[model samples]
Target: MIGAMWKGMSGIYQQDRGIAVESNNLANSSTVGHKKDQITFADLLYTNGGMGHGVGSQSVSKQFQQGQIVGTGVGIDVALEGKGFMVVRSRENPDEIFYTRAGNLVQAKDGFLVNQDDYKMQGLVPQSRLTSSTNPADTMFTDEFARNIVSTNISNSLGRIFNINAKTTDYASSAKNDDIAQKGDNYKSSQSKINDVDALREDYINKLKEYQLTPNVPEISSQAQKSQVDFSSKISSLTSEDNKLSITVGNKTFSVEFDHDGNINQDEMEKLYNFLDDSGREKYGLIDPSSIPTQDDIDNMPITTPEEIQAKADRQSLRDNSINAYSSAKSLVKAMQDLSDKISAYAGYSSSAKSGTLEIEGLIQGKEFKISEVELNNEKINSTNIQEAIKGSGMAMIDSAKEALKQAVEKADAKYLEITNVLDYADLNTIGMTDLNVRLDVLGLADKDVADVEISDDGFIFVKSGDNKFLVGRLSTASFRNEQGLNPAGGNLYSQTDLSGNPFNADTMNTIKGKSLERANVDYGTTLTQIMVYQKAFEANSKSITTSDEFLQTAIGLIK
Candidate 1:
């Protein structure tokens, strides 16, 4: 009876412990990153050939099962999808490190990323300090701790926590500004300082635009020929009775002849004037008869005396002989005009006679044509005197302009390329960490206000500032070889032990879900059911103790 009573007492104690464990699990069912506790019962001792003495609580261990992930739509909330824990260090104790699955992170006032308990998250950083070394390595840090801790002494290790308080002005230099200024004259005198990443990008883009040059050389669709000559002046000095001027245009030739008295042939002159009038009537729908006086009009004029008659006759003779030359110079303006009209009709060219000079120009820019022959009084004029023969001079001027434009573009493009190379190096050397401010500082975007924050499926954190997006940092996770061996450090945190081994980089299969959190793995239904079972066992143990007491009371009464 005594042994039975002792066994019942032991059972009662074990059941009570079981009840407490279940109750704890049920209470923490909604806790974030909470794992359920499982209690195991065992027989205390064996006596009398395998007869158990009593039941006792063996152990209470965490289940470590995966929890349900719920999205909270928060920028800093993160949930682990696989087996891993986010590495963090305590704010109160810098040397103390803890691991957790909770990802409710926030940026502190000092610009460091920390969890709800204000524990700073650990992550990798660029090989060099944010303010130094243009080239940085992409590798893991030897020390497990983050380099983000603010200390006056610089460490030799590359690992650091994130600090994102850097600005574009931190990296800006007068030499870089001078590189951009060399691209164009507009920027040479104004060396503006870059205040932010967006401003730096804008400056580079503007400098690039200066080098995007397009040649403006005129398009010559067809060849052209031009000639200028003092034909009227040369014709007036004609001393021969048979003075002839001939010009050829395309397949047609026009020739004019002077009579023995050095006067243009009257019949030919009258025919030329008539042809012009007829052409004007056909083309412009109007006849210009008043352009030249007709011979019949002079013959019809009246005369009063012999002297007057003689005077009229002399005037008529002079008019017929000189063709009404300007100021009695006897220029062949009328002859040249008539001949030019004939040539213009056959060839794509126009000619005019003024002040005893005749000028001809080809109407088409690049159409191949020529003034094949030009002769006056049986003498050939030199080709050098014509403007078209020296067209090389005009072409040389155009070539010079083109060369200048080419050199300007080359210079601008070279500087633009140099600036782009620098940007590429900066991007390649950049490293990521968990802290938003540190990430911004490394990316030279700390001066800009963040518009949005996003975490990629691959663990990259990006922040938007105005119209530009910058990579702030990457979330870091640690995995253990024996997770169950980890020592619970309270507040959903665990510390490394000899059995758990040191924390290492997580497997590639592990991923992160942003804007979400892992719910406690405890099952309320199972916990409640276990609690009922424990209650029944407790009652059975109490009944056994009561029954033993009743029997002992009966024995004592019988003996009395």
Candidate 2:
């Protein structure tokens, strides 16, 4: 009976331990990178018979099964996809190393990649920096080369592994110091030339604007009127024997003859005006003559004089006419005005009759024009009678400046392209170096602002600074022969033991998933079920102890 009680007490103790283990697993169901603990029971001290001692908790081991991977969209967060652990070292003690699946990382103020505990992540750098060469046979540092170099350098221990640093510096000194210095000088010279050309181009543009605004208006005018003459007397004098007037505009010519009674041929006059209007329209592409606003249109009525009817012959013919045949001075003035208007229209010039003077001006601001020929009554008018043409100095200067500006712009663009290619080549040569400051110095961007830092799926660390991105280093991972034999250290970390051989570089199949994390592998439902079973077994053992006590009490009572 006493032995039975002892047996029940042992069962109760083991069942209590089993409950504790299941409870622990349930509590850590949401812990990141947590593994569930499993407990096993065994009988102790087997006797000669088949019956054995009460059951006791034998061993507790961690189940190293894969966890569910979930995306967190964080740039620094990473997760292992297969069988491997990210290697990290103690910040205070460099010799102490640990492996973990928790990849929530942060950048320290000192420019090192660290976890929340400030443990620095291990990384590998290239063995040697690539050389900048123009030769086709030269080996270039490509993405594939970067991966291969990192894999080759990985080791079981942190033998030569280093913490990745993101600090930048200017002008990294190297063995080929003279070559780098010469390149730097060339870059500065090209940049200076660009600045000078830019200033010159701006000056030229301003000058062009000034020239366009202030044009050289070339104008020619006939002499002012001397005195007025009587209308009827002048007409009679001019029409003594049916005088004929011939005018030429551009390539077309027309003639008008007056009758013996001082009346003009209306049909002939109409033909002359029509030719001038049509020729003007065809040459200058001017709008329809009827659409042009006249002085009468501005005044909203017909302006008339006492001898206007006699001078113009009819209102329809005088609608757009500026002529007044009241005197020889008027007649001559009107004739000049008519000739100027026709020539101006056909040759893209502006004409006006004001203050008894007829003038013709060039349409373009800084351009010049001349009347090719002018004749009246079969006598050619002397060139001296017309004003001399004005030269377009401003326009000539603008054209010359435009050509020079275009050439300067082209040269500046080509120089910029060349500088860009050189910088790119320099970046490629220095990217894989082990030292972060050296990489920045060699690329001449130590003072540039860092934009972002990202870890790729293949574990490459990229630092974007200014307009360029540099490959700083690669993250390192390790794998053990027997992962279940690893000792569980606090904070989701594991330490290698004799049972678990020394960690080696993770196989190629194990990759990193950036911006994601692995959830704990503890199953809530299975843990809850195990807890219930342990609770029932504990109650049964307690009942057994009580029943054994009752039997002892019955036996003792019967003996009394």
Candidate 3:
């Protein structure tokens, strides 16, 4: 009986162990990445040869089934969609990493991100900096090119105006020659040579002599030369024909029209020249010149003189002409240079005579993705719906979590089927996954319809079918010796034991996870079952020890 009592006590200790495991699972039901423990026993001895020993608790293992991750709509709340535990640091010491299911992440005050245990996630940069086609300096250079174009054109216009001014002296000298010829080349009689025949002045004087009886160039006698006065035919030589230039200021073109006849008025021509030059300045300065901040406003201001205004009409015309000819070419060249410079830098840009377009290709993370298209349940599907559903029916909008779950499962199943059929499918192009965009446009359900689906990964499958969330993951569990032997400071997580060997991660080969999370594998029902087994084995061992004692007592009594 004493032996039986000791054996029973041993069984109680094993039962106590199972109870502790149960308590632990209950305590951390909401804990992230927490796994449940299972207890088993081995009989210390058998019913053979000598006396036997009592039973004891043997292995306390774990179940790696997928745990459900509730949707918090918070960026930090990350659930393992398929397999693997989140390696997090404890809040007290973030330097240590621990394997866990808790993926509630948040940004630190300094901008570094931390998980629930406050472990800083690895992979600081998810992607390397993009290798863009354009460079920063190239963009700036293009802007300068556009700016350079206008500057050149402005200068060109200025040069044209300066030349017009210099040409004024030339026009005046030509007129002076005409004036001298018209005055008869000297003071008096026989002045037939006063105007050139081809010139208007010549015709005017000829008419005056022929019909008006104006004086003719009568032959001069030798006596005339001898007298104090000279009467020579040097007038004709002075009036020798020369084509004269006529400058039209504002008529149309900035043109210098020359003719054989002296019909153009000298005064009018000078007026046109001055007018064109001044007007050119007024307009040139007005033209959106260069972007040079160096240009002084007052210095470049146009038309300060009245003389310039008087010739405004001709000057305006000249300005117009310059725009089409020299200005157009200069501006065109400037534009091209500007365009080249811009294109060199802006990777998103494309140019055509039709129109230019800029296309930027990029991606962002944690954008909300909806699991369903059909609205169901009273819950809101998205942020927008959240407020409304909460207000009217204590929900922002219709919640389509059920439908979304179905779709996720359907997707996984379809993908699995396709992959299996392909056998060795490697080409992504064949899958047409370029449109593999997932949308969380709404929180509850999408206006578009979607079918129920399952998504599979190498580690596990997500069983997202019809809201059957309870029986989600089909996981394969394993354990190691001295979990603390894995190395590094502990976050209450033990690595594979030295005796156990290398530790690695694995999931159900052909099982599905709860689209969200699975309940803890540690069950009270299982613990109770273990308790019964331990009690029975201990009792048998105690009976054997008791039987040995009874036989020895009887033998001693018989000997007496």
Candidate 4:
């Protein structure tokens, strides 16, 4: 009776614990990234043969199955679709690392990415500090920004020098202004200071070229070419008969010939004017007849003034001194652009050349990857000739393209350094060259506040401000060999234990970006059913104890 009572008591205790576990699961069913908890029961040791022991709680385990991933439409919110947890370190205690499926992240006051508990998220360090790292994009951007600063500085300095020279010349020639003497004194001091800076012009240029700043040269040259107006088109549109010039603007065409040799041609000029007036060309606003120069207007115009002449002469002088600098800069940009174009063309060709399908397990084939075999047209001589003219086997096409691109870029790079020397000697140069406006979207200025942040599927974090986009860091994910072995270390984080193998970076494909979250894996119906079953078992165990007590009471009464 005592053994039976003890066994019933054990069953009651175990069932009560089982009920608690089910209740906890039901309570946390709505929690984000929550995993369901399961309680296992085991039979206790039996003493004698053919005798069973009461049930006892074995262990409480977490179900590590995947949770529901739902979209939240928030930029920083990330959800793991597969088996991985985001790695985070306790902000207050940096050495303590925790893994979590809960990705409700926010930027803390210090700009570190943190979860809801303010734990700092672990990520790859920003690439900017790793200068030796092999990131081609980073290299390109650093070079571009450096060159931008140098070029802007050079342009401003040249402009300042030009203004100073113009003013000094005017002061020396004629002392018209009252402040001329004071200005002269200032000019002397400014000129001395400028010359000192000018001495280092070579050094700045060398630094700019050392960065290999050539990405925008091609684009700038193209814009410059477009800005050069074509006068030939206008000239071609004009119809001149005898001594009259006729031009069309919109739908109206008017012809007028000037006969200024003071002869019968005057009558023709008059006749042309009468015809235009009769056609109502001036009244209808087709053309302004008065704007066209009459003989009187031409003769009455003032001759060039001494001031104007002086101005023109000064401009010519400036141009003469600076032409070499301008030409050199222009040449460098053009070469860089040309090289860039060739690289793009060859890169495309190489891709096309290698795109053809090949049999992997087939026998040896002759004339593999022949560019001649790839054709837009069968009869085109140039197309066929290019493949023949290219000196190498078909397999070498991509290699050849890569080599050409590399050489072109390098040659342009060499010429870039030469520009600094040219600019050093060209003292009177003004930066009259049009702005390149190279849109290097990757570069960001330091100390600028971030406008927005984005997380990519590949775990790269990008921060943007206006036109600038910065690569801040890369988010890292951790995966475990035995995920269930992870212990719940409060605040929705898990701690690694001996049972779980050391964490490794999660497979790349497991991470999903954008505004998404993983929902809890708890099943309400199943938990509710578990609670009911445990409650019934608890009542039955209590009844068995009650029955034993009743039987003992009856035996005591019989003895009485």
Q: What is the C-alpha lDDT of each candidate?
A: 0.54, 0.52, 0.30, 0.45
Question: Per-residue lDDT of 1-560 in model 2, one digit per residue for the tens?
Answer: 88789999999999999999999888887777778899999998988897678887788898878888899887777888888888788878777888888888887666677776877777654443423222323232222111110111111122222121111111111111122222211112333334434444454445445544554533222111121111122233454444543444335553444433323233433322343334322322323334434445455543487575444445444433422221223343344444444433332233433323334443222234433344444444433224433333353554344334333333333211100111111121121212222133333323433346667776766655443445556677778899888998878788899999988767354778878888888888888899999999999999999999999999999999
Error of 1 at 20 (Å): 1.2
Residue 299, candidate 2: alpha-carbon lDDT: 52
Q: Candidates sorted by TM-score, descending order?
A: 1, 4, 2, 3
lDDT string for model 1 (1-560, tens) is 88889999998999999999888888888878988888898887798798789987777787778899999998778888988888888778778888898877777766567878888877643333332211123111112111111111111122222222111112223213333312211121112222222232332233223222312333232234666654543544565456677876556677777532434445544433443334222322222324435577667766888987886787577555346332222225445555554444332345544323445654433233455567778676532225442212222332222222222222222111110001111221322223334344434433433346666555555565433344455677778888888888888899999989977777353778888899998887888999999999999999999999998889899999
Query: Candidate 1: RMSD over Cα atoms?
Result: 22.0
lDDT string, candidate 3, 1-560, tens digits: 45555565676666667667666667766565566666677767756766545658887676666665464533233455444443444456545434544444454543333554455543211111111111222211111121110000001111110000000011111222213212211111112111111122222222222322212233221100000111111111212133111111112111111122223233433322232234333432323223212223323446568765545544555444443333322222222223322321221111111111111110001012121221112121221111111111100111122112122222222110000000112222221111111111111111222223222222121212122111111122222333423432333244444564543432321222233433444555764565566456546645656775787688789999
**TM-score for candidate 1, residues paired by index:** 0.48
Winner on lDDT (1 vs 2)? 1
Pick by lDDT: which candidate is best? 1
TM-score of each: 0.48, 0.47, 0.34, 0.48
Better of 2 and 3 by TM-score: 2
Ranking by lDDT: 1, 2, 4, 3
Worst 10-residue stretch by lDDT in candidate 4? 160-169
> Among all windows of ten consecutive residues in candidate 1, which has the lowest summed lDDT?
416-425
- Stretch of 10 with least lDDT, candidate 3: 160-169
* Candidate 1 local lDDT, residue 115: 78
Highest-scoring model, TM-score = 1
